[model samples]
Target: MNEKIKNFADSISPLIFLDFLFESRKNLTRLIIYFVISLGLIITVFFMQLSYSDSSRAGVINAFFIIICTSSALIGGTYSAASITSEKEKKTLTLLRMSGISGVQIIIGKIVSGFIYMLALSLPYLVLTLLLTLFGDFNFFRLAGGLFMWAGFTFFYLAAGVLISVLFKKNASANSFFYFSMFTLHFLISLLDEWFYRPLYDYSSYKFFTNLSPIDVWVNFSSSHLYGSTYYGNDGISSLFNGTVPDYAVITLLYILFSIILTLFAANIFEKYLRWRED
Candidate 1:
């Protein structure tokens, strides 16, 4: 059992280490650009809040910041996806294959690196968001819960992106697939909501659709409107009422579950689909 655990750890470590080495290359450039853009936007929002009469200016500003973090996560996935596909293009994937690393390791490493890079690039803005919320009289637990919700969504996006990276050999092809997947998921949910969940929406149909989509689960985790969503309870920050909401402990665990499922799903596909061409 110990040996099995060690081997499993060994497989993922090199990929994680490689990410650190590769960090000096393309990721550095992305880190700089993302930081500059994110910080600049946060500052702009902060200054703009000075002119607003509403004391809830902090809520408005934090919402704006959270939106930016969400956007950064999306963009981060794109960059991470592109990074892997570009390696495939450069023929380095073959070398990694020959080096005794499995596809699982490669994918896991890529996910870890991408997640870390994103956390690093966005942490400052996130801290700033929290700090402003603190001064702005926002609920501490609420703000913290929202950030955890964001991380869950981030993992989902990153896994989907890595899956796309593995499936497509070209950068454009991979990106196109990513966007198509995004659109399809969004479009289907929209249809379900408008046609089924709207005026006369039924609980049965809502459960069916939401079950198939962790994205909906993610949406329910963040949006107060969606907390009482038909399928799931918004017990966390998603709770609409001023009742006793669940703490970050519960929210974080749920998010981690979603992230683990997505990551494992990606790894499974990477092993099942790509092994042939890679070998």
Candidate 2:
């Protein structure tokens, strides 16, 4: 038990994680620029559509989802992408391997720390959303659903980033591939609608294909009105009161499960890319 505890402790040494966070803080300018641009764009969009014959509240909510999802995905691509590649690039993995550190330990540390960073990035947006709810009839329940959806997206991207980090030698290549693959995952399915799947929207296989994108999960959540939605996201966030499962809830569960699978897969093959040099 003592040995197990010690291994876990060493895996997530506070000093290492703190330094990692410090480096992130050093990139404050880029973070701020991204925040400002995304926030400005969404706010502008909300006000612009408010004057039109549209659902202002729902529009803003959807915009917030887009911003939050994009930011969280970028965080995963950067932080998780570097988790293993940095150690490998600096030749520190050899020392960790020699020091009796296991692949599982490394992954746990990376994911835990990356999750913290992801939360930090999302904090401002969360606060803003809360404040918005105060003045409007904005459903707090919906906000909760959106936040849950973002968490699922965060986990999925983090897992994908780690797997990419393991496969690529350089962080640059890993980040690029992470972004490309994720975009492909989320966007490519929709293209089928323009050509083939649009007419078959009600088909089981069609529903299955649409469900593959996290964006679809968010869309399902955004469509809910005052009353809670049903199992397949055919209702609102208040569905818990109605004893029905919301669509996002099911998708979030799937995301967590998929992330676990990806993490395990990465850990299983982690050692192939690490080697020790003796003097």
Off by over 4 Å in 1: 1-11, 20-24, 27-58, 194-259, 273-279
Clashing pairs in 2: 228-236, 228-239, 229-235, 229-236
Cα RMSD, each candidate: 5.5, 5.4
Candidate 1 per-residue lDDT, tens place, 108-189, comes to 7888777776777667667666656655556665566667666766776777788778778899998888877776764465
Determine the C-alpha RMSD for candidate 1 after optimal superposition of all C-alphas. 5.5
> For candidate 2, lDDT tens digit of each residue in 178-240?
889888878887565446655665533444556656777766666653234433532233344
The local lDDT score (0 to 100) that residue 148 gets in candidate 1 is: 65
lDDT of each model, Cα atoms only? 0.63, 0.71
Model 2: runs farther than 4 Å from truth? 1-10, 31-55, 98-100, 138-140, 190-205, 225-243, 271-279
Give residue 269's lDDT in candidate 1 (0 to 100).
74
